[model samples]
Target: MEAPPVTSMPVTGGAVNMMEYLLQGSVLDQALESLLHRLRGLSDNMDPETFTDHELVYLLKGQQGNPFILRARRSLSHPTSPWHLRYLGQPEVGDKSRHALVRNCVDVAASHSLPEFLNEMGFRMDHEFTANGHIFRKGVMKIVVSKLSRILVPGNTENTERLSLSYLVELSVLAPAGQDTVSEDMRSFAEQLKPLVHLEKIDPSKQRH
Candidate 1:
């Protein structure tokens, strides 16, 4: 799949400095067990929580192209929770050696009326899907192992089809921008996963081409 487009938006309150560092990689079927074992050993706590989420991707058309891509997501398991709205900007590249991605982002917790509000703003729902995963947290980093599936019918997340057999693994952290040291931490943590899955930044631009 092509990566989502990036756009700039004004920051509200303390979110001005908040930037997200991410590394994307995949786990083969045979290697999943080893990776899970390593994660259990590395985490501060014993158990990891699982989550199922359904996400809707929305796009706003502009004169040139689709200028804004918005992601609205809500948990499938927890019906009471509100939906989440997120916007991620272009990846920031620093010195040539870094493998972690830094991007400007905005995340909002929205009420049930979010879809109506977005429609009023002229955004159209483009696509939707579901992901089932186990999330492990270690200090500042979040490690997710998930499998994506396509929604067979709109607004009916229960009926879906698997997109692939391999699991998508992502290691990420959200921190204030200019915190270069966070990359080092991300690298070190990823190293522990080792041969099971080599987690590194996958440039979205490269993926597009």
Candidate 2:
């Protein structure tokens, strides 16, 4: 059977403009277990979900400015789940009082043929990686603790190399724009995990140079 062609739609059209609030930090491999244990205690009552995802980042270049980027992620462990397609704008330059980095973002669930469709739309695959992690949620906030691996071959997910001896920790929330209160809650939650993992707002742009 042939999969349906994926089409792009406006994800930011609604009345409520959505933004992603994010705080990022990392922990050494030896301390990953301890951080996970602490997260279990601080997270919601639901069982923590584990996932192994293969993610590909695609770039679309235009005549001007930086190329637009998109991330397509699929769960390797749960093949039946739909693929996640995400568009993340650059980090916002807000006041120092904001606890987390804020960015305009959109997430869409796509069919299995997403890669083919994206290729047809002129998006070039920039890079690929595997992320296996435990996910935790508290209210609207989401926490992901994952170790990233470099794909050894272009299309082989089985052959990979661990990127580093550390696990990347991300604390994120998707909420309406201008909701600075969300950052406050994230900061408070991050405090609880302190000494274990220190989550802070990191701007990717600043790290480029």
Clashing pairs in 1: none
Q: Tens-digit lDDT track for model 1 on 1-209?
A: 32342224345654366778998899976778888888999977947789999999999998996478889999999978999999877686544565588787778899978889999999999999999988999899999999899999898998999898788999988887667688898999999888788998877878886
Give the TM-scores of the predictions, in the order they appear.
0.89, 0.92
Give the clash count for each candidate. Answer: 0, 0
Clashing pairs in 2: none
- Candidate 1 — worst ten consecutive residues by lDDT sum? 1-10
Local error of candidate 1 at residue 123 (angstroms): 0.7
Off by over 4 Å in 2: 1-15
lDDT of 2 by residue, 1-209 (tens): 31121112234554556788999999999999999999999999997899899999999999998898999999999999999999887676455788998777888899999999999999999999999989999999999999999999988999999999999999999997778899999999999999989999886868888
User: Each candidate: RMSD to true structure?
Assistant: 3.6, 7.2
**Candidate lDDT (C-alpha), each:** 0.84, 0.88
